[model samples]
Target: MTSDSAALPGERADFLQTLDTHRGFLRYTVRDLTDEQAARRTTVSELCLGGLIKHVSGVEARWMRFAVGGAPAMEAAEPGGAVAWEERFRMTEGETLAGLLEAYERVAAETDALVVSLPDLDRVQALPVAPWFEPGATWSVRRVLLHVIAETAQHAGHADIIRESLDGAKTMG
Candidate 1:
């Protein structure tokens, strides 16, 4: 993102740029695919290209929610239905690769702007209730941003493999 395009300060721009790089790579994996192609599972892993995008989108949105609101507040914002482990890794009914990517981009941009505007990246928040997270582990907002970046980047790599297996497409050379 350019300075003229986004108002992020120097400190925040680095974070945004790193995130944008991986985000673009992930999006590239499913480009020009039909819904069926995107939902295909080429590896033994259940993860599909469309589902990876949706997973990252939901993850970032939740973390951003926690940053803007306290843990308790963020808990209240959760969707009524819980996402099952396997379901989280595949595109569900009525979902398409293109549609998920579009929504992911919107959420990703919002997350970037929100992170840039934070007065202090060191600000901390309690983690939401989850069996996987340590009982008392809390994360700083900056840590949350870093975590999102790591999560997205890992998933991007997974998406690249899935794409390649499906049709020999590569997100990057």
Candidate 2:
């Protein structure tokens, strides 16, 4: 659950630490949980714990790709697609919490390696057309990493709430 980005100093370490803190929150929320438990929608939100993790993992992977390459095509498998959006909220058939967790760990490891090895944090990429994004925009890799961290943190909070509603477990307590 550790990130190599923490080994460095300055903004890199700070960013990694922030990301790790939230990742830890999410990891703890899902620990000791079974497939059924993770799949449970404890709150009114359609997002289950496993689904949240999957969504985050996929998003990080895509952004990492964008950082390394350019943005994907409009019809690509990016999350904005109708199918991807629906699948992002829950475990699809044959997907388990453990399996998704393992995949997420792999994605996290790759993302950390990229973050640490990239020579230029300022490398920028133009964002793809999306309703949620501006008509034309670009973001640096560093900004993308920060966005990942922020997203993970937000979902961690949601997971905490869902965990509490499920079995009265509180990650913050």
Candidate 3:
């Protein structure tokens, strides 16, 4: 009998592969960085390498909750308020690159597992309330996966720029 841990079928495999590729770019950008280097803000923007990893991990985890259980699930999974929100983009005291990366690996693994076991990518969830979201909009599990992929790719690009500025390191040409 086929099982959740078995090799995923085509579309699911493609999603996981694409997600991993972009995640690799982000991880590669931070290779060998010290916690201080990862935390340092290279540009005027608040973005930092470690913070991007933390932020992406949290985002993926939250959205995957949404994918499985809709908006309330996502909100319940997230830390609340402006301060908590702002912290996602900066490294606070005692936050280390290694710790952040480890957390990210866990989140990624959870997402990969969910994608494999989920029965219906087409199952829909009403999106959580936010100014950025359309009023009353709903998204399917497949759309959530797509959003996660896009978020990872976009943040990887941002991380690359920050890394290059930090020490002339580039994840790709």
Candidate 4:
């Protein structure tokens, strides 16, 4: 377990460990890659190693805001529409793999600290209005953490595939 998670209670520590493990996998997948290589599209999907990091960072940050202040905090945090959403999947001009990784680490640190300090994991907040979500749905802090973990793990898998396609490197055998 990481030092940050070591002092946390059982459930929270578990969340931190699990999240860290997947974050490590995603970071490892981009090991030693150049910025250009990290930004290269290896499949029909717009995803790239750096872009996955960027997207996941944004997602986790947004969800943490939701955890702290519900849906409104999340909506107010990022001021963007469809175009900005699309940009999250690709490295824009002046973006670098190192810079993206650093930003991701910062987000991860903030999330870890928040998770540890939150008064209750059971605190529930109503979800935002979206067709993908059921109307009147609410999620606990635990649920948000779970969603963040799922998102990280899913993107880590995507990064693994992209990394493998880019070179012969694999996150695991």
TM-score of each: 0.88, 0.90, 0.93, 0.95
Q: Is candidate 2 or candidate 3 better by TM-score?
A: 3
Clashing pairs in 1: none
Candidate 2 residue-pair clash tally? 0
Report backbone clashes per prediction.
0, 0, 0, 0
1-173: candidate 2 lDDT, tens digit per residue: 34466567787777777877888888899989989999899877899999988888887788888888867632356543455577887988888988988888888888777778889999988888889888779989998988999899999999999988889888887
Q: Name the regions of candidate 1 deviating beyond 4 angstroms.
A: 1-7, 77-82
Identify the runs in model 2 with alpha carbons over 4 angstroms from their true place: 1-4, 73-83
Count of backbone collisions within predicted model 4: 0
* RMSD each, Å: 2.2, 2.8, 2.9, 2.0
Residue 55, candidate 1: Cα error in Å is 0.4
lDDT of 2: 0.83
Looking at candidate 2, what is the lDDT of residue 35? 90
Residue 3's lDDT within candidate 4 is: 67
lDDT, each prediction: 0.82, 0.83, 0.89, 0.91
Error of 3 at 91 (Å): 1.1
Sort by TM-score, best first: what order?
A: 4, 3, 2, 1
Per-residue error (Å), model 3, residue 41: 0.4
